[model samples]
Target: MEHFVVSARKYRPQTFKDVVGQQAITNTLQNAIENNHLAQALLFTGPRGVGKTTCARILAKMINSDGSEATSEEDFAFNIFELDAASNNSVDDIRNLTDQVRIPPQVGKYKVYIIDEVHMLSQAAFNAFLKTLEEPPKHCIFILATTEKHKIIPTILSRCQIFDFKRISVKDAKEYLKYIADEQGIQAEDDALHIIAQKADGAMRDALSIFDRVVSFSGKNLTRQAVTENLNVLDYETYFTSTDLILQNKIPELLLQFNSTLSKGFDGHHYISGLASHFRDLLVCKNPSTIELLEVGEQTKVIYQEQAQLASQEFLLKGIQLANDCDLKYKTSKNQRLLVELCLMQLASITFDGEKKNSKHFIIPPSYFKSKGVAPIPVQRPDTISEQPQEPISKEPVTEIKEVPEEVQKPVIEEVVSTPEPVINLSITKPSKSSSGLSLSSIKKKKEHLIKQMDVIIDEEELPKDDFTEEQMVSVWNEYAQRLDKKGEKIMASILQMDVPKLRDNKICIELSNSTLKVELERAQYPLMKYLRKSLNNYDIVLDITVNEEIEKKYAFTTQEKYEKLKEKNPNIELLKKTFGLDI
Candidate 1:
């Protein structure tokens, strides 16, 4: 049996030339070394395992390099001082480092001090090293390395020339890993390395660590399956297949895919999230410039490319939106699976502009009216038959109201509805209320002509006239409505829009088509009535609200809906079978 070193340590870089994915920082350092324009202190900061400490070590070895690795005895002593701040983080240790700072280097011209995790140093240690750091010995150079640069004090930061190391990009990381694997003559797949790079999450050392593990699991030969299975990753195949089903409207196949993934222990949320990320990748792949930034195995990339090629730009756009919305709604959702399933179903049905079932409050188009076969009807006044003349000389509404006999009414009332919880008959697309058989114009005439005659005579005998114009009074009314609206009085705002106001027999009458609007308007009558009478110089005014018919727009059911209801009432004598073994 042979013991193998992990790739993280085995393939570690020894010089600035060998450092990966930090060309900007390395180039700057090489330039500084070549020009001999190095600062007294250098700070290296970035994410974990991205070559901070390795670069510091390389810098130390290079600056302290002697004639030979074997012959120079002084190379062992003052050439490099590597300190781990995590362990030696006290004031005494820093004081000792400061004391040793005065000595000139024996082997190299300059002694380099590299402090790893420098942010771990105590406050007292930082304070002790402040002066020595700002003004170190002529023979000494300082290099501080940290994963979190923000934790380091600003005073210390000012003394050093900072170099920020970036995360190893997926492309660079994949390429480097391939180079290493090929050099070792290891059989590996490009997708395997790509997975390792993605899992590395911008850290070179982490990438190498994952590479080492995969190599062990795969022995001398590497396969894409080994990498995905070992890493517990759900491949792009599931996403591609599911999305295809959704796009083709194959909901059964979509659910089958979901059930299989769930049975494999993939969570509903993770599955949805992966679906979201997959759609996002497709979106990115559709664009030329951003495609390079996407992280995926070669096979996955190919799959994405194929989908991107086949899918319309609009399909990808809306699919991504639905997936993202599902992801956001997943946490708080009670039926999470259904939520994801519904999103998938909607995504499958989504056309470029989406299906245009009328939105709530969305007006019906002319085409819809034409399809429903609705025509404008003339308004008719109520008429009585000559035989019913002795019934009454009533001037009330004339709509036919059915009267229920007492014996038959109880069961009808009892059977009207019965449920454990009250069911609210609300509509997402239905117009709220049906129009009453009344007209606004008729109501306005009765208001202005009749109310004005009686109120004008009484107004002259009341308080002073010419105090306020009708518009000013309306503005006052509107202001009151505005104030009420700011206090979450939306109903008041709706009532204010009714707008018709008239005075009859020294009383103010306001006509509203909506009963709810009328109720809300009546609530404001006490304060508004007082304000109006005071402002109008007419104390003989009372506020009255009546329902107006003109604004009461009809709420009609669609032809399809009406047909469905009629069919439900009688049902089909025979079971109607639809396509694909489904009966509707």
Candidate 2:
């Protein structure tokens, strides 16, 4: 059997030109080497798998080359000394290394020492090697590479030329993977490679490692499904499916999809975070200028654009917010899965049209119902109530009217003839009462509907303004208050009975102890005013409420105040208090 070589090691960059995604660093090194300005001590620092060690080896080999084809093939391994600082991070090791630094290269003009994970060296070892590192032999060159630059001492940093290696970008990584697939005679899908690159997260070595595993799992025919399955990653299709379900307002299907994802052993955190990114990507696809920001295969980009068209900016923004909130709360949430489920449900409801989700905030235009062949219902009120009843007309045979559905009654009401009585045609469509269990949103919509109904203005000039005494108005007001008491609105009833109504022209003014009562009475005034108008036959009557703090002082709210009131009523209370030495 032929020995299998991992793509990471097999396709490693051989020269500066072959290095991926570090052109700036590579060019600088090459230029320095060409000009003989290469630092004797060089520190290469960055994240893992981003070519710190690889570049060191390449630089070491290139420094010894004479630019001839023959010398180019020579790796000059004899002149290069590699050390793993993690395993040999002691003062003794530093002493031995410094001892070696004194010896000149036997094969090359300059000897190269490459130390990997240099930050692992102990403080003592670092101190021991600082002198040699600062003043190395003319023939010795040291290259230090570390993932964590902060751990290295500042003195050592000051003595070396630092090169910051950046993580490989997804685009560059995907293109490189494509080249590798072509070289290996493998048929790889673009989306499959793109996923691999994304999974690598800007590390070329990791990308190559993932590519090898995926290729081994799927053989020569590399596909997106095989890659995702091998990597145990949620595919782009999962998020696409999720987004589609949310856009369609399919909560059940979205939850089922989430369950399936969880069943596949994915973390709820991962799912929610990916969903947020999916929303962000969709938002990016919304505009032509931002399409380049989406890092996906061309096919997936087109799919994103299509989905973006289906999602409104508002929906996408809100979807992202909800998904992100779920992500942030996932770790702290005791019921993590439930938290994610709720987030998904909210996302699905973002674009929901059923039940008039936004009815509390927005009223649907009447034309909307008219467009659907429905007419507004007109409510009629008698302009004037006759003081005396008319005698019954000679019994004429009357045609019986058949009962019809409310839907049919709507159109019939629209066609009603204009009479002496005024008709109010409400333009706002009334939402049907939900038979489902109570919810705050439903309660809010009902309250808002009632407020809107009360807001409908009736012409005061056309209404009856019959003159009535303050006594009659007070009687009707107390009757309404007593009715409210029977109906369990004791707060409002108490507010009404706090003071008698004082008639000022058509206005009935009532003073209360505080502003809170005023607000409550105002909110409940619609029903109260309706009752008073109907009873007194005065549609022009209005309620005026005011708050007087003095009203609160008139009534004794505390024992001391009651004692003071008693003393004011009779001087004997004060004399009794002096005789008994009462606490009051």
Candidate 3:
């Protein structure tokens, strides 16, 4: 049997040049060592697996080297020392380390002490090591590494030179993994490597570890499908397919796809969040300058650009909003699957024309009707009505007719009854030669006259004129007011209920305290009148409103007035007030 080694340990970088990302920190360290300006006490603070310890080891070895090939080849293991502060975070351990700092190096010019996880040291230990760290011996050089810099005491931080390390980028990590794969004689796809890099989330060590696991799963031939299956992650194609379904407004298919995802053991939250990211990526690919912001394989980038062309800016913005909202509501929602399905349906409806219908702001989509096998009927405009030609009328003796000016005369059609002797009386008026003066007020009055004439013509039509008692009218009026209240029109309902209706012939008269109430009722009279007439079965129903300022004045509006009114109602009320010494 052969021994298997993990890629993280087997492919670790040994030199400063070989370190990925954090080039600024690495270069600064190299220059400092070359210029002999290296600080004796140094602190390395950053996230895990970003080349902090590797750089520490490389720095120790490089400083010991005298620039000769043989010196560089020598590991100088005896001169370098490594410590885990997490395990030995005590005053005695720090005291022992300080004691060893006094001894000179056996092989190297400077003895290097590397303390990993330096933040774990106790307060007493930190205080004990501060003085030695502030003024270390010439032969001893200290290098401290920690993931959390704030945990360390401020006094200790002040004594050592700090270096902030950055997380490795996906591009740099993928390139490093590719180099490793080539060295191991393994064939890896670009997308497969890209996914591995992204899964690491800016950690080189984690990326290498994931790469090793994926390589073991798929052997030498590493494809995207194998990588996604091994990592249990939703692939880019899944998101791409979801987005396409949303763009096409295929709600049923989108729901099915979501069901499949859940059946495969993926969470609805994960699916929706990834869909939001997919929308963001498509938005990024919309413009040329922002294309670089997208982090995907070259082949996938082309696919994204093609999808971006089909999706508009408005659709993408709305899709992102809906998906993100669903994501936030997922955990709190009672029906988690239904919430995600609704979000998917909304995303699918973003670009659908039928969803826009009469207004773009309509929440209920027209597709609901189509799904129920209902076809929407188009409404026709009044002007679209066709005009039919009339037949010629037989000449007869006119019995009676009204005259209009010759210049403004329009044809009037009348029905004639056949008889032995038909009588017709027609009269014509000559146009006046004098022209009328034109003014804005005159034109307004003329318009009002025309409107009144049209209303009279409409009112002349025959309609039902059934009679109803005042009690019936009042009952119907109260019912309408209650209906208004239920519909959230409380103000209108109160106004309607303020006074009872009085029937005088076909006219229903109402008296209100002020003109404001009358005006409000008049504005909303059409629907009220329609309901009243239909309920009473009387087409001749008319609502007459009257306002009396004297009636308004009779109501007790102030405290003194109310007190006077109460005293007038009962003479003993004044005695009760005086007996109680009540102030009004």
Candidate 4:
């Protein structure tokens, strides 16, 4: 039996050319070595598993091997020295290294020292190593590698040439993993490799580790399902199914899907976040230029593009927002499951208009009842008597409404607006009739009458316009601001209170303190302008808003500012501060 070795260690890059996802850095080093322009001290820094230490080792070997690959690790043992700075980060360890640097190499013309995680060195040790780095012996080279470049002192950094390593891209990592799988004679799916690459997050070492683990679990055959199962990753199929349910406004189905996911031990927060990503991917696929941004398997991407076609850009954007909001609120929500379920319901209703005007702020579509038809639960309006004079109050047959599916009835809701009638204020109790007693013909007549009345109400014409003075406009503006304040729009009210509108020709020009206020006012421009026009009796009152970028800066709100203000009021305050040695 052979001893087991992880793929990360077994396939570590042995040559500069063998290194993946670092062409620029590797090419620069290769050119320097070829031209004999190698810096005595070189610093390689970047995130972990991005080939910092690996490159350091490769560079050390290549320099001593005359820019050729060494046949074996033992061949460079005499000339190459490696130190773990994490454990040996002390002045004494550095002194010993400095002593070793003075000795001439026996086998090669140059001697190399590779220090891993060099930033782990203390300030004193770094200072001690500085002199040797700045001016080393003629035949000695120093290669320092670290994941954190900021921790290293500037003095040491100035004396060395820096090489920043970037994370291996998903494409490059996938290719490398495929190459490894091919070499191992294992059959691997592209989606499986893509998932592993994404899971690695730009780290080749992590990717290889994941690949080995997956291979061990599933033998030599790898599939998307196997990888997802082993890694506990949320399946893309789940998202696709959920999106279909949402597009159909199937609230019950979406909630069931969420419940199924939760049953698999996936966190609610994770599920919601994944849902947001799924929507984002769909949105990205909607554009040609942005399609490349969608990171998924080729087959999965095709599915995404297909799903993207089913959803409008507006629906995708709103779905993403609702999912993100659910994710953000999932943590603090008292009923975590309910929060996610509500977000799912909102997503299911993204394209729905079943909710009434009273609950317009809420994103809830009609709740589907299994017992009733597919139509959303309709909210009953309070009955009111008409003020119009009639011959007499007649007893009429109640109307019976047909059960229509919500999707089929959505258009009717958009086309019909309920008309308000004056209440009779009758206190007398009346016997109630059952829905079964109502006739369909009577219901049809009542609906027709309601629609006709709504049409008449909507077709009503505006009053004739009359010119008004600037004083009247100002009064209306103030009144509008008061109305906004009453509606709990304090920010908008404050903005309106800050500036008075000026009548320039026929246009009403309003200046705001900042662009934020300007945007808010512009968003509500139609309604605000309509109210002002109605109150001032001017139909042609055009609103023009301008943002003043050079708004006056306000005083600081810190305790230091308060202390400084106090100091200016009394000279004795400074003396007291000096006596007490207070920190301000």
Candidate 5:
């Protein structure tokens, strides 16, 4: 078998231009070499694998200027020493290095020393090197590299020039990965490369490692499925499927997909994490400026752009929230599957249109996402009730109600005449102290809202005689059932099910399942009575709520009892039946 060197090492960038997505750092380094204005002690710090040590090596090569392998001792232009502080962290090592620094460069004008992971050095070693580091020999230079800059003492940081290496952009990383893929003559799908880039997460070395591992599994033919499966990645297909279902508002289908994912052996937490990342990508892909941050293959990028066109920012935001909620609740939930299922259910309900209200706060249409600002969310109070239908009153009350038209009454005038009902505030909108120590505007707004509500209530005072029909009563039951569901009151909903209500003599008699329900009805009796009296001008007609036996239990008829009832009810009917020659 022929030994195959992985694409990562084979296609490693030799020149500064080849380094991915870090132009700023490369340019600064190149400038320092060209100007001969290099700092003696340089500190390179940032996240791991973002080219801190790599840049240091590059810097070392530039300083010494050896053959193609600038790392060789024979190629040393001066005296350039490279040390791994993780291993050579003793005071003896530092003392020896310091002693050697006093000697002049053997071959070149200035000597260079490079130390990787300098934070690993012992306190005594750092103390030993401090004096030489602060004011070293004129012919000597020093370079220090670390992933965690904070671990290094501030004293050391102040003495050396600091250069921060930023994370490589996804766009920049993809280009480099492409260069490698093309160089290796590998048949890698764009999505395959995108998976490698995403897995790398802005580290060139890590990207290379992932690419190598994937190549080993895929051989020369790198397919999207091969890469994702080998690396245990959640495929873009899953996200695409989920997002499409959500956009279509298919909650059941969404949950089915979620169950399918779980059956495939995917972790709930991982699913949530990927969804968050996917949403993040969609957010970044919203504008041209942010698209550069989206790290995926060219083909996948196109797919994302298409989806972004399909998805609104509002949808992404709400969908992401649902996904995040699933993640947070995943661990604590006893029935983990149900928790995840609920999340998908919630996600499917999210409409990008401004009309979809935030389950958290306000409801706005998805169209609102397109606009520059948000429409204020309407207030909701927990105990608040909407206006009830008109009452059925006697003919006299109808005439009184007909008299109050043709008035655009103002609040300021109305408040003085009638005591205004207080506005229902579900949220705490407590007035804050203002310049004069009282917020009159806030108080006025509350009072005004209250007055308006009272006016609406007063408007329903005019009742027609025998106003509500059975159909109307059933409709009210259904509406209240839905309201109870929204409030998570299943108990109340079940009782409302026995609500085959009828309008009897202007009073509503709702059949109950049992006396328990009848008791609940009685508890609600006062509000029901007041509302009925107001809606129907029949104060004399009282509600005769009863637990009707037929409503309570379903019974079967026995043959003997049926005969007895028939015989008792009609003695003359028997003689007439005998005359008619009738048989039972």
Candidate 6:
């Protein structure tokens, strides 16, 4: 059997028209040759496997072939000189090349020198080659290729014609692969070729190599399933199924699917990152103009559009955010699997009701009334039993109590029972202490009358007026600060502790350090004033707060000022600074 050659070397482009994804550069070079406007030195810079060296060789052959198409590589072997600078990067190597440049071409009109990885040349070598590059022989042409143009000195760049080659696009690579498959009589699917293109990441050589590997593994027929299995890539159906389950709020199914995926030795972070990308693709499909941005096969694109119709824009955006956040936190979390599960739960519950339930407080029992010897007297209705004594129901509303007279105040409780027609409201009060032979019904009537009388007295009561001293006001102010501290308001407590209350014109004035303190004190003014009045028996007390600007002026202006202050507090600081010879 004859030796087998790899696809990368066997299928390399020979003519300018055959180069993929580099039309602009090829067109420029060809036009320059056809018009006889070729430069002495040319620099080709770009990523690897982008047809830089190949273009250099093709240009060299075309210059000697009178701009004619040269399909065979052996046509220009005599005039073309290829150098690997990675091995021969020294002053001697450059000296030998410059010596060769002085001689004329034997087989062609011009000699083309092609240097690969030219950035690897030593500084002395580059210096030695600069003179020849600036003004070369009339019969010599230099072509330098490098992946890193920045490493080349500016002097070298300014002396040559520069051409930047871009990476091969996926569309171009996939079409080239299809042509090759047809030539080889192999059956292939669109999705299988697309996978190979994506795996190449804009490198034509890499794509061809991957295509050859898959063919060797899956025989003559190339299928999507075979490509995915061979490359160990997660299937597109995995992401589609996961998204459908999340949209339907099927948490259990999603978890089981994730578990199954993990069992196959796939990383959780990769899965989540892929999920985020899937969401991004869905968002792109949301708009008709952006549909082309999604890079997938035709069938996969249709599936994405159908799913994008079901997923709301807000849901898709939020899902992307959640997945990205989970991916970032996955490496730091101790329980990685639990974190992912929790994220899934939160995503599923995003549309749940957010209004929390309010806790209900139970009412105090009626045993207090019974313990005070007060029984609830029930007013009999016509439909009720006639055996119990009939008590007349009072038709008055209950009022707030102030002070009840001894003559009418009685310990009596009324129980309201539901009758066939109407519900009677009742009142319960303290019972009488004397043996006055008062029945339950009469005591209930007296309690009701006294409750109304007390309301009238309270409405007519007078307000109290008292005076508090400065010391008493300061004492109560500090007490309030302690209370705030106990309630976990440390900043408020610190504000109060740092300021003191002053007496002015029969009123209390509160002094604070800054505006922040003033605002905090203002929020609690009402409650604090109420507490002070009840404590000091002075309801007419007044408080005025002002920020003292003079106090804030005492702060340090610079490091020197702070050091001086420290020196005043500790004289040994000066001695320490002098010993260390410190400067401000």
| Better by TM-score, candidate 5 or 2 | 2
lDDT tens per residue, model 2, 1-584: 99998888899888888899999999999999999999899999998898988899988988888886433346567888899999999999999998888888778798999999999999999999989998899999999999999999999999999999998999999999999999999999999999999999989999999888888799999999998899999998899999888877666678899999999999999999998999999999999999999999999899999999988999888888888888888889999998998778777766756334433223233333343453233222245334476455444422234556667667755664334344333222333353212333444566676546542334456778788899999999999989989999888888899898899987999999888888988999898989999999999888889998999877636887778778889999788878999778
Candidate 4: segments with Cα more than 4 A from true spot: 67-69, 73-75, 355-361, 365-584
lDDT of 5 by residue, 229-307 (tens): 8888789889988889878866656778888888888898898778878988988889999997876777888889888
TM-score of 2: 0.68
Better of 2 and 6 by lDDT: 2
Candidate 3 per-residue lDDT, tens place, 1-584, comes to 88998888887787888999989999999999999999999999999999989999989888888776534347576788899999999999999999999998888789999999999999999999989999999988999999999999999999999999998999999999999999999999999999999999999999999998998899999999999999999999999898888788777778899999999999999999999999999999999999999999999999999999999999999888888999999999999998888778767766766422343332334435344453233222335434566345345312234576655453321322233233233333543343222223444566676445431212323567787778889999999999999999999999987777798988889888898899999999999999998898888878899997877877638888888888889999888879999897
Identify the runs in model 5 with alpha carbons over 4 angstroms from their true place: 1-13, 66-74, 280-293, 309-313, 331-334, 351-584
TM-score of predicted structure 1:
0.61
Going through the candidates in the order shown, the clash numbers are: 4, 0, 6, 1, 17, 2
Cα misplacement distance, residue 438 of candidate 3 (Å): 59
Q: Residue 560's C-alpha lDDT in candidate 1?
A: 65
Q: Candidate 1: deviation at residue 123, Å?
A: 1.9
- lDDT string, candidate 6, 357-461, tens digits: 121211112232232354344444456434677457556523333454554334322212233344332232442343221335456777686445431212212
Model 6 residue 134 CA deviation (Å) reads 1.1
**Evaluated with TM-score, which candidate comes out highest?**
3
For model 4 the TM-score comes to: 0.66
lDDT of 6: 0.81
Better of 1 and 6 by lDDT: 6
Poorest lDDT segment (10 consecutive residues) of candidate 5: 397-406
When sorted by TM-score, best at the front, the candidate numbers are 3, 2, 4, 6, 1, 5
What candidate 2 gets wrong by more than 4 Å, as runs, is 70-76, 359-584
